[model samples]
Target: MFSCYYCNFCKNRKTTGPFTQIPNPKSVLILPKKKKKNRAAHQYHLHLSSVAAGRQPSPLRRPLSPASSVIGAHHRCVPVKLLLPPSPAFTTVVAFSAPAFSRRGPTSFQISALKPEEEAASVAKAQKLRALQTQFFSFHHNKIYTKEAVELSAKLLEINPESYTPWNYRKLAVEHYLSQPDCNPDSIKSVLDDELRVVENALRQNFKSYGAWHHRKWVISKGHSSIDNELRLLDKFQKADSRNFHAWNYRRFVAESMKRSEQDELKYTEDMIYKNFSNYSAWHNRSVLLSALFEKKAEGFLSKEKVLPEEYEFIHQAIFTDPDDQSGWFYHLWLLDQTVTTDSPLLASSWPAHGYDVLLVEERCYNVTVECGFNKNEDLLWKPLSASNSQTARVWVAHLKIPSSDLHSTVEVSVGHSKGIISTRGFEYSHPSMFSFKVHVQPMERDFSQVSVAESISLREENFMIYGTQSEESIINSFNQLSIKNGHESTASNWRSEALAKEIECFRELKIGKLTLARLLMACDVMSYPFANKLVHSEEVLELYSDLMKLDPTHYQYYKDEHSMVLLQKVTSSKESLLQHCFQYKDSVSSAICGPICLRLNNLSLSRMGAFEKLLWVQMLDLSDNELQSIEGLEAMQLISCLSLRNNKLRSLTALEPLRKLKLLRVLDISYNEIGDHSIDTTRYLCSSPLSHSVGSESNKDETVTSDVALIDNWEAFYIFKDFNLNQLDIVGNTIADEKFKSVLVKIVPKLKQLDGKLLG
Candidate 1:
């Protein structure tokens, strides 16, 4: 058995061992590079011969099979491992083969001459070539950077130094060979000198080769360049072609690498700027290059000449030239915002070393004061009006005369990044995007009246900052503190008081109906209680209620006998003594709520109550089509669950949370409300609990059991409504990816469902 090698080639495909054969062996060909190693080579051939016969492939000595003996031709077997048929590469090797041996080979497709004199002449030529190669290796490899190799390299350099192959080889000779075992540093310097000489020759040979310039880059990358030499060397290329971007690029790279970038980078940037202002790649690279120069020349360059970090003239020139390439303006805005921006000092401090005002202009229309966006949350800020202007939309900044040692002594403004925008005219201004101020305040949107009502939500001034819904932790403490100072809650309660007094008065007049105001006041009860426990204590409100009670017989009767109304029931049916009537009731209104002959508080304002008491209070009331703003009323309706607030101007799903706990109230029709995109997230919260959910959950369905089977299909899709068999799911949003994300989510919460409108069995 023989193991295969080289893609379907059997390695020892001849014989098992030397001097041994399988069924019967004949001849074998032995190839030995040196005549002294013929015996070992013979054994190798023998082993291969046996392996070819499929004999036991002995690891010690696998033999070759005789092709003639196996196929009955007695033809000599050849051992050349010609994986592919003869090609140009194989023919090249025939130049070195021995004539006698070469002529006897089977693959003799090239030559067959047997001339003795010619063979003698070939032998002489071979000897001379061998001597030359031996001399070359001895001097180059023996003395460890021997003077001879250096000398020869110098001569070679003079001839054709620009040839990359030799230059690379020269690099290897110096860097690799000189760094070996006992190689001397001084000798290595000589080799480097030789390398430089060779490079010079190559450049002088053909300065047009980009490879030569690139090679010089590699040399400089290793710190092998001198300012004088680099300048002098680069001049050669510049003299050849002035507009050569490659030469300029190389010059820029070298200037950056060296510590001597006084104004060279900016000089290059300015050059590129003036040559072609609209070249974005050159400008972008210039930004990177300038950072280094700015770091180097922070003192005189800025102080004496007032040289800015990013010059507007150079960058603006690009825009001025084309005024169309957005990238040019982008860089310009980047420059202005970047200069003078220091990190934010703790509280009160001057700005950093930068000295330019950057402005972010939105579509070139709205301008915001922003530094160059160099921070994470730059896009989210609006520029401060203090720093912005419409023309060129740059921040106004005067370079501060600050020192390095005293930099930390004074606090400074933080250099924040802004969203940059470019105009069709190629004028770039940064829009004060996300991170425009000390505190993030989202711009208010327009009002319903289409006014510029996008409120100026200065975080320092707003009432309450809503962090997140349900996640009270997200509400920043600052917002909470500000709320107290702003007096928002006090203002809200006052409105509730007014609405309450007005409703009671309307009942007395029997003119404005129940919608006058009493219902709204009752809904504002934070305790979720129906009415004031001791109404006699509170006066103006009580007077209004009394006046309404006296207006009509029906109104008087309902008020007199009412105690079980869901909104203000508190009806204590004790057999003590007291029989007081608040509203008029013509019949057993307590039982029928409102038996036609009796009246009902149908249009009650049940919003604003944030807590629920959990009881059947009222039903079949047309509370629908009212301006009940919030869902806060749903928390208190423990018993009075049948709600119909359809065809009204309600905008919140907030009241639904408390409603989820009510085990009673069933049919809810909140349709025709202006619940937009935000309503989706809000709705999911209200209907999440057991009673609030549309689905009838069973005891057996826990989180673990459903994680595997249904979740694979359920993850991308969420089941919102499941009444019996009618299931509606939403699966077409976000990146649900494969079922894996879904599988994991089901494990987190197995009861989540988002439904489309449907009536399930």
Candidate 2:
């Protein structure tokens, strides 16, 4: 059995017990005895079991005191400092609401009852509180009782702290007091401090009190309280209950207001995370801090040498400790999503030593400076003419001079943002003005993070001195080896052997390093490098993916997608083999390594399509006049810009829904298919399905109008591709109502320039 207690602020006592289990005082009373002085006739015991079952309780009578009535749920109760301790994570708290409780006592909530002696006192207190509330409301509406209103609000708030109305009234009162000429600095500070303390007291009662926290922010904004003290209080609040979203938000506000160092906040987040790895608040806090801390780092903060390793390790440890925790996984994804500077080449290919103009190619349209440095006796730097900043404009012109006798010298150009250096041996030049050089630029399309990291790792002499100061090629090779290894290696091998060795090392590390979320992440990382860098497939990749599928069943599809890509990459070297697997797997090849080879051969009769995942770059596809019946495999082709499916066995237009994700699609050819007959009833059949109905509304239209007018007006509503701005459509041989179909199709795709090779007038 649980006991009940009453707070001095609120005269209500709360204790929850099952209605049938707890003894009913009403049943025990034989007749009316002397009424208890502290206990009011309105007080009654409240059963919690009924509330838990979603039943509304009967209306409660007016208590002797306003403090006897709790305004909000205990879960929402903003606890007072002198009352019970804070609740944890906003969950149900069970405590005996007795008077013998300390500041750090276990949290308890109950519907309170009053005693005989307190009944008289409660009535007087209720009367005083009523007078104060009435006075505050009068000043709020009339704006005459300023000083009295503020004092009344304070008194009313002490009884019912959660009431936003009284808090707002107090704010108006404080603002008026500050506006007066008598308001000195010390007086203002004293008032602000007092306000902050009141808010703190309210927060202790209800940690999630929105009004209290908001008032605290206003008080802090007035430059009255120490942010350090606020932070300390927030720290304690978070420690008491880490998932207090309000406290976390307040901490961020105070930290930002004080311009607190991100490093300190990051450390605090780390401490909280160490205490509870599942705390998403701490992880989210870390993400915001990282973004703020590295906002100005040109190459991005993660691309820095010192930062990536430590960050990877930290996230690794977090996930390793709790593999099921979503917080660390999300943070890891955020780390990977940071924009790595795009590494574009200054020149695509080596240039001949002549006085010809060189062409520079930049990957993206970002404005950047390009400098050409000639190294002979001394280094000379020169800037090329300004190039138009557009990603579509692939070529930039730069003048170059090469001497015939100075073939041993080198001419180097620095790409902006430390992308890399592109240089060529001095070309043979006859006349400085007559001869011109042509430099072809090949832009690297990969993210700059890996490139920058690889470059940084390769430049460390102490790490690779054993190989002797090597050429650029050897340094790169060594860097790849080191990166793939889980730990230090005695000797490095060629690409294939190194990849295999790394896989084995990852396996060993997984076994030795305790099976953790980090192990799975590390395994995925080490296993992916082989295919990402060297196109070497290992059993370890598929195995780890399988393990991840089991560990994170929620993301099983993701592992499947990655597994398919790895398998596709292994056979990419052989064009014939790649096409065979592409047909078998139905996935597009990575554009970085190979363009998606066309597999459309009418002679090769295919009946089915396979769903493939890694096709972010696929733009055009031709699959016309094949024995295809379903569009089941088209879901993963999100980048398809032009799709050809003319003269196939497609009987319904319903198959076109999967193409909605292909926002870039501009041309579609589905001509000469047995879609429907040349009857007006065909529109009814197409529009009847739920998927078709999603295309347009039938709400306002009559049955006949829905078949004609609604069908024409909202024709694009038939499928997901209604949004595609199709410039051309080929439905020539279909036996549908050609005129009506064309009209509706045109309305669906307004930019339709051609229909079945005929211009849409």
Candidate 3:
């Protein structure tokens, strides 16, 4: 038997006997006395044996009486069988007072029995929140501009700061408050300050909150906060997280608003970089500020001559400290690009090498109007020799109506502001009645007389020394002796070229930044020197790209593209290649066709087509059997008519979008490609299945079922070929080359006379 204190309603005050076990017990009812607080009343019952009812009761061993109003007092244990009511809503807290489980005080356990009242309270709370949202939205929708509405918005926004609508409503409310007749600057400031406080609280919860940040900007724009305070706040935010781009952008906005000098901002960025070199945002900001300073030539800032070297040194230190960091490397490349200057597009050469009726300008030009002495008009219409109807082309052709009077005179041709004179005396009149003449405009001759023999020898010797070639020294000396005999002048050495050579050597010795070294070599060779000079480091650049492909296999394709670009540049830059292969090629009849220039570049394994500006003259190109996956650069071949992309890795027809401008394209060979089979027949069959029964039943009726067929005709291939008037197309050996595709191809290209090498009857 457990000994414990009984309830106050017990009959005996003192202990009498040991607790006795009853065989069967009757139920004893107990009720809680009403409290002055008017709490919910509850009735409890206890069961006791019939034998215990007749026994003398002990204080510690007595069963709870039926009229017991109170449970055991504090620190008491009552051993009684609890019987709950049948009502589902009955709820109570059952507390157990017992001896200490350890050295602690008496262990009390509570069973939290939930009540109807607590559940009701929870439901009321949710209802209140919903009502608050409804009221806030009602005010927003109705455009309510009252003090109460603003307070209500604040209440909602405090719970969810990211809610943009509430922030907007607050802005509207502030505007309404300012528009009041009695609204003074002090009052306006007070309202805005409170709004700023709300935004600040939201920022404290989530520093990157976009709505809070935007609201802060709006508040500052309204002349509520001082620039110093805003900057200090931004400083705090940036100090917490240096890479916060939003904070940086806002800081720039603040600086712009105040018209602060970029020089000060430059110092600030330097400080940020010093604190953390890995901060790309700081580096980017520094680049912008420095570029602006150079452009403006701002006083007290580093001059253009001094700034580049200093920045280079700064970035060099950064990269050397951390080789794997990309920030410093990117900035360094930018600085290098800035140092290199690109030459403007000039008239490279012209075709018809003598006097001719048809004139071809061998450089990309737009809005070409030519003024010639042969033509009566001041400007004759010259069209781009482009089959794609492009605005620009390397070869611009014009058929001049040359008058008989000007045939013997020197014909002056003017393209834009630049003018060139062609002697009509050299023209041979093949057709005297038609007035056909051939005029060739050759490039101006370079003056080699000014070149110094001694400087040439010294430069060659320096180059040879860098290469460490003893055999080439004798050859160079012989060349120098020839130059001396030919009577050339003396000049100073090219210090810039020597400096680049030294830098290249230094980078080679360091053996780091292979990509950087490769780019530097390219800039030194291609950009640093004039077009007439030979590229000294082209071979080394190509070798570096090859090494990079192996070293960084993840960017292998990128390196391969770069290698292709360099190779194409070398080929295009050659005088012989440009004149002989590109321009002077003739048809089988040994006569120059006035049509598009044809270039046979097949089997070159070219993944990318570089030097687009140089090859814009080409109209008929054979690019078959290579690693070409996409025809992106082919659009630049605006004059192309016949294009063969057979046995390539073209996977999608969408890659043909670049060729959409090639309106003159007729003969196309896309055979053996990987284009997917998005057959129109399949789509038609799927869409027509539901209408088949209807057609069969309504065979006698006049209802047409061509809607599904019409829908199926809008495939991608149809769209790509809709504007095309192709006469010959070969799509054989591809997955898309089914019989249905062949039938659709005939419909898509209505002018087609041949498909897949077979005549489309």
Candidate 4:
């Protein structure tokens, strides 16, 4: 019998022969040729037959089929109708011939039936895996930390390095073995070395395996592996994949353990960065090392005068090399944040213009002490007038004992460390009479001259290159005008401002890095010369963010939030606006009353509220219709009583923890927010009462009540409003506004007289 095979090249094909029974079909190698355009397609076939002892095959003849051809010796072409059969006992090679079949080549592959041996092996492996897992867990549960158990865990880990449970169990087994009474230093080293070798093998399978890396660190921590060997291993891993953060983190750990010099690490980062400027890890590491080196004043590093500029140049080179790379830009922003100074806490103003009985200091201070020169200089204790009664407050009040005779003399008042000379020469000399006076403390001017003249000139030259001489002069003139308007000296030689302006111009011209330009403008506006002046480019920053949203629509939400932050800063930076919006004055029968101010900051799209110290005196603040997700900065509004955070994105009542400090707060409106049940229930508060037990039957009742109180106190909202003295709270239009939640709220706030605009029964 002979087997016949057909090729797919023929449109319609038929073959007939007695198929030979082969022991194994998979042993046949079928090489398929790749199809090419405009090539002759041909299919080769192997023929087998059996003949009598002396029989000879027929001689070669002319092509029986017009399309068929014979190539090798002893080969013959037969007609398609011919059907040859092999003897049942013996098979012999007959000839190679072509037929109407499809073309195939070495590139093609065939899916054959799986052999019985392979299928059986797969099942056996699965069974072994199950058995190993069963034994491993048994050993773990039984606390069997023996050599056999350790070997079983090793076998399991070899199958899957990501199995963290096995890795942990193996560590425990090693530790147990080490703690044995028979174990010595040598034995301990040997065991640890074996563990390290196991971890090494696992890492070889997967260098990025978290479990393997963690185990390696544990073994190294046991003082088994040498630092040099570990470092070399890290070098190999990092070289293979430079952006592998796991390897980089492990390298950092090893370096710290070895107490490697920061300068050396910094050099390593530089080398990595030089090899691949797009590597974010290398750039981030470089930033960290550079900051540390600068702080320590490390030798062979750039001096303070050259540090920023040189680093900026390096970053610019990288950015210009690959305009799309974001690593350099991020590092640049980090450097700016580290170097630039913003609005730090300082004494801004004091009230009582001349001589008065009470002094009010408006500044963010942890402690304020007033020393008056009236009765031979005395340091009077100051108290925070803010309702929070916090030590660190924005408004501190102190009372002074004014002498009738000294009212017309020069008196000096010292607030904290800042001193103000109050001239009482023109005031009436009245005994025990209070008078209103105001003193404004000017923030010290930043000396731009500290920046070396040579550096300034170099920066200016670089600016001229980016923004041509004509444009550079225009920017300088514009900044100078802003400085003069804000009551600051000219920025003709302000190197920092000039450099920032130039960078902004370059980015604007290139029409790239919208975020980068916005940040640069913010830094320049905040850290401009004569730091006391108003922000120079806040409006520009806002507009740039708007452009960023349009340019990069994918990050529209982020840019919008940033825009809100900048707008908030701009509004708060102006003390005049803050006072106008927050303070309310009314005439009384006997005296003028100035308190319980109402600041309506509605519909500002504010995501974040900053400079809360400025709003410390505001009592009724409405921050409705904003994008505020959290109320973290509201803690400084210690005097706030009526606050409306309505129609915002607040997702939980726990975010209102900051409001708990407003001890005087009475009315709260948190309606139409994303507050949900999960957030409400998960909110926890620490128990304020100490754990104690009493004796007697009455004590049992008290203890039971105490336990119930403790359970209720676990909810943070209940704890926040326990002593709030709140008369009204509005939580309408929220997920947790159902009747059940209302009942829960009533329990949390017992003093509530009204709930969601209705009087509570």
Candidate 5:
């Protein structure tokens, strides 16, 4: 018997193995290819069989079906293995071939099998689709936007609506068609609506698909929009998710384009807020609508004298209903903010009185100069009214005393700024009016109003110091009368008493381990009530603030600072006592805070002079914008690091010599001062002497006894702090000439890495 076995593919025999070569004894048979895709399976079979042999195999003689082969030829070789019978007399021959089957070959159009016939059909369809996609993309890349190109992109978009590239190509295709000068508007509108539908359908499939939304916006923006319908669509989107800011933004755009009535928009926002007061977007939108609605009204809630009490009620209701809702509180704040304003100038009485009178003026004015008729021209002392007030407003007071016999003296008043000065046209001797000592006090706002009111009262008390009990009683009576007129009974007899009561109440709450909103509000009201202009210095307030520090550690410094401010206000004697008190409580207060508050203390009364030596532990000191003539007291603070003396009255670098002992000092800001650096002796320590060793130290107390040398007359004389390790030095806003400063200062301060806020090379 003779038997033959064949494979779809064959390999050449490189070496003889196992089977013997056979002579021609049997006929050969080849099977036909089944179908287009199945031909690849046939080719794979042939290739496998050829590899099993050791010789180079011949290629398949038959052609492949169209779908499997790109070049219309079979690339695989088929090999046949034959087994010959031992004798021809026992003749029986059989041939066996491997099973015929098909595989979807690895190509761009490849599809996994489902059913045999289905997979073949699917693969053929995918191949045609891929070819079509390639042609379409090629046309798009080449900038072809013809009708056919548009159709192609439409089909691509149908397959992948979220694909940005296809959407962009589609937009380009439509735009190209519309760009033709002869294009009719109706035709364009029809095309645009169709494009809109495409995006709408895409959105229906995937609502949050960015490309679909963007394309819809683009289509509408090209003058094809029905804004009313667009708004309705956006409303639906927002209904799905009320907090969707994007949908809200789109709705706003449509509403604006359609010129939606402000009232209607406001009502819409109100509806949204009513649904969810915590929705920040709705609240924010409501605020915008309210502003727009109120802009034209003279007595609008956010405008002039006629404040919107109803708006206030609404906001208050929202906040009270949900205390945790920041949106309500934020809107409430916006409602309370001041609008555009007019002018009110301040009037200052004699220094002994130190009283301020705010005068209503038609024109805005800042600086006021008062001149009393005398033998020669004299300028009175004048400054800004307070730290928080505008610089344009000045308080002018003089120390001049008028003789009893010559009580009627003419005075000239002028108010102006950098532009020049404008004086009253005529000088006159004026008599005091019935309302001379009375000042109108407005209702205190929330939060810091207490501090402001108290500070004001403190100023008034200081001004009336010389008048004794009668003047004090008169001022109290004036405040009482004003409060009665305003229809509110005076909360306390006076500013001090009211402040003390607030302090007590704040402490009582702390003792119970509670700081409720009601209590906090009551504290604010109590502090701000009765129109007091005196500083509260209650120990209980300080203690309450200390307790608050623990409860709200994030604002610990703020509480400690308020505590320090309260204590300083109580310091009736020397300013050094304030510094001492601050130092005593230094464990609770931060170092940087003391300086500005200390400056405020000095400005409050201007009655302190001494070494700040007792404040030994303070590290950072900001003495900016103060009336300091010298830095003589800083020697005691050896641990000081940052010192800001900007906008001061120091005239020479000699005042800075005390800083030499402060070796830890690094940042020194003396900008905007009148200090000069003309050659002066600068002391440099050859060795660091212990802080204990004063100038009086008796180590062989004779002339030229120590290694310390004074560099005299050289520009290096300004280098006293060379050993102090000063890295940052600010001298900005000074009149120091470039020639003098460059030749002198930079050479001396070689260790400085920063000068006047600029980094040095």
Candidate 6:
């Protein structure tokens, strides 16, 4: 039964707590009205059997098990203030709905979450060593739990009840501990006593450390305790800050604990309602309570046990009376769902096996799974779930629709193995490689939450087939169409001799900007090395550090560019320099200039780059025809991300990287390259991906010396991967994808999400 008392702010008024109504006048009518005479029949052994259509209770009573002993379940999340007690972490009470698929059968989710060991010393030591982070991550990945941890923690707190650290540590440590799996047989009784004592200690200790008190209440409320103490830990933290949310939250926790054991929950419920009915947090707590009651009542209905059919009706009446009260709704749902499903965690590698309830804790994420049990050969569909108390549930339906095509099959999976099925007929192309850096080389890959996680395998590029530019190819065939269109037949020879001149002009202008190549590089983006190496003579590309430096005056032994100072250290041979540079400021250049740098930087090594890259690999290269047309795949390469085809007779824009994702390509001076407007216009592939930022690599150098950051000489339009510029789109080296500039035909352009030149043309 549930009820909602009146509130002025019912609409804007967020409510809490689970308030179920007790049975009243509406209930008795369902019974035989031998009325006054039958009342005499209720007198003896027929007590509970009265509802069974007449059965007698066995006089023998059984003792309750220590672990399964019920304090009863609350269907809704209690208000933060009541259930958790107000604390800094108890920000506000908010209701969330769980995904509908959270039901499952007998199989518990196999999780590798660890149970942490206890020790006042270890708690402090672990925090200091950052072992908790490491250990948590380790267990999270492996899905293993430890029983020693649960026993050790539960035991340590009993010895020193007032120690808040171990108590809290124990709380975090036991998150994944299932009752039977983690419980220690030898210490079960002592552990229960210790938990109660901790709560008692928390109440005794000025009764105000909200963190300590709230934690204790949660521990005791799990139903392992018979004692419930509610006290005000007066100004526990000495009012260094009076509005401490943590302390205030704890006060709320103690209030909810009072309801742990109640023969008549209404009296306590009324007291709580009157205590601070206006306190929304408390109201939220009430909602969870009501929800739990609803679930219990539902269990009775399912079992043919002692149940009040009319009483179930009363729960509905309360829900209608106060539509916004969470407690009532939660309880009503609980009674409805108990037989339907068990709360199960998701099969992802990131989330915990426990913590599936959102309102159950202050968390950022949750995982849920759902399963449908059926007779053999029946299709899995059509199940009922009108009732349940879940705030954060994610359901994974075990049974699913058959594939529309005869391409693949679905099989049950669990931990210790992964989804490895692949078919030639059905495959998704966009999924990233499932390589992991972990020691195991499992044949299957994890596709769930593990994408873009911290566990992917690290692969470096291994081989190359770099080729260089040959002399400018025949002018007539390359420039035929463009020459006729622009009336530039007279200037055809003129443009062929001018590409290097433009490169020289751009370099000389940077000098006029009062910055050398070093200063410019310090401010370079992904183009740092490629732009600088372009300035170096090509013959010196293979020169060793000492040998090349002795022969070239233009070459320095070593100098910092716009990367990290650590990068410099990594490039060097001296270990002492590496260590010394670590302590310097990130603001200044550290090393003196020295180097005979590689000048023969070429393109053969580049075709095989990875999804991610550092600027060190950039170099000048020629793309003649290692199967070349457009450089579309090189979109992310700002300097190398660009390509030059002065000699190749390319015909279409298909060879270019989608321009939308490249912000670093500034020099599209394919002046002497072969191309014509007849090919296509430049709007094929575009995107909104984040572009690389211009990092001052010189500043990245050890701060022992100072260097200024300067970049582009005469370019005003810089491309960050996010912003797309059409004017910078150059199809000079190749024929446009279309013969008639089809991109301009559309009257109003739709936002370009994706454009394949072949399709657009």
Task: Report backbone clashes per prediction.
Answer: 94, 39, 13, 14, 24, 89
Error of 4 at 564 (Å): 1.4
lDDT scores of the candidates, listed in order: 0.34, 0.45, 0.52, 0.54, 0.43, 0.27
Better of 1 and 3 by lDDT: 3
Tens-place lDDT per residue, model 4, 643-752, is: 78889877666557567556667778889988873433222221122221211211223433244554364454554455566777788999867887677778767777
Best-to-worst TM-score order = 4, 3, 2, 5, 1, 6
TM-scores for candidates 1 onward, in order: 0.28, 0.43, 0.60, 0.62, 0.37, 0.21
Name the best candidate (by TM-score). Answer: 4
Candidate 4 regions off by >4 Å? 1-127, 300-303, 341-499, 528-533, 579-591, 676-716, 759-761
Per lDDT, what order, best first?
4, 3, 2, 5, 1, 6
The model with the greater lDDT, 4 or 6, is: 4
Estimate, for each residue in 401-462, the C-alpha lDDT of model 5 and write its tens digit. 43445434443333222222222212121222122222222322221111121121111112
| Worst ten in a row by lDDT for model 5 | 1-10
Residue-level lDDT for 714 in candidate 4: 44
lDDT of 3 by residue, 1-761 (tens): 00000011001112111111211010100112333333443433321111111122221122222111112112233344444433321122222222111101112333454599998987886787788899999999998977788888877777666668889989888888888899988888889899998888887766756678889899989876666777888899999988565577688889988898898899898999888886766776777777677657688544444566567778777776765554566566566655553112222222222232222211233443345565564555554433233544433445445455444434554433433311121111121111122443332232111212222101111121111133224223322221111111211125434545655786788777777787778767644222333456778888887886674543455566566666666665544444333321132112222323345555666665665544554556667786665564455454566677888766656556556656557667788877774322211211112323322321234433355474274465654666676777778888877888777777767787777656656
Query: lDDT by residue for model 6 over 1-761, one digit each (tens)?
Result: 00001101001111111110111111111122332322121111111101110011111111111111112111222222112222221112212221111011011222243346545666776464454445544543554446555444434434433345556665655454435576664455455566556555545543334345567657656665544333433234313323233433554455455643322443444454454322222333334444445446443333312232332344445444543333343343333222121122111111111111001101111222122121231333311110011222111112233333423332221221222211111211111111111111122222111112122211111212211121011111111111111111221122222322332344345322111222222222112121121223211212222232242212121211111121321222122221221111111111331111111112222222211111212222234322223342233222222233434333333223233333333223232334454333221212111121222211232322112111131011122121332222233333432423324211112222222212221
Model 2 per-residue lDDT tens digits across residues 171-244: 87778888999889898888888788788777777676767888888888877667788877987888788966
Q: lDDT score, residue 243, model 5?
A: 51
Q: What is the C-alpha RMSD of each candidate to the true structure, in Å?
A: 34.7, 21.4, 30.6, 26.9, 32.4, 33.2
Off by over 4 Å in 5: 1-175, 198-218, 298-307, 338-761
**Prediction 2 global C-alpha lDDT:** 0.45
Error at 579, model 3, angstroms: 9.1
TM value for model 6: 0.21
Model 2 spans > 4 angstroms off: 1-187, 243-245, 252-534, 537-619, 622-641, 644-666, 669-743, 748-761
Q: Native-vs-model 3 lDDT?
A: 0.52
Candidate 3 matches the true fold with a TM-score of: 0.60
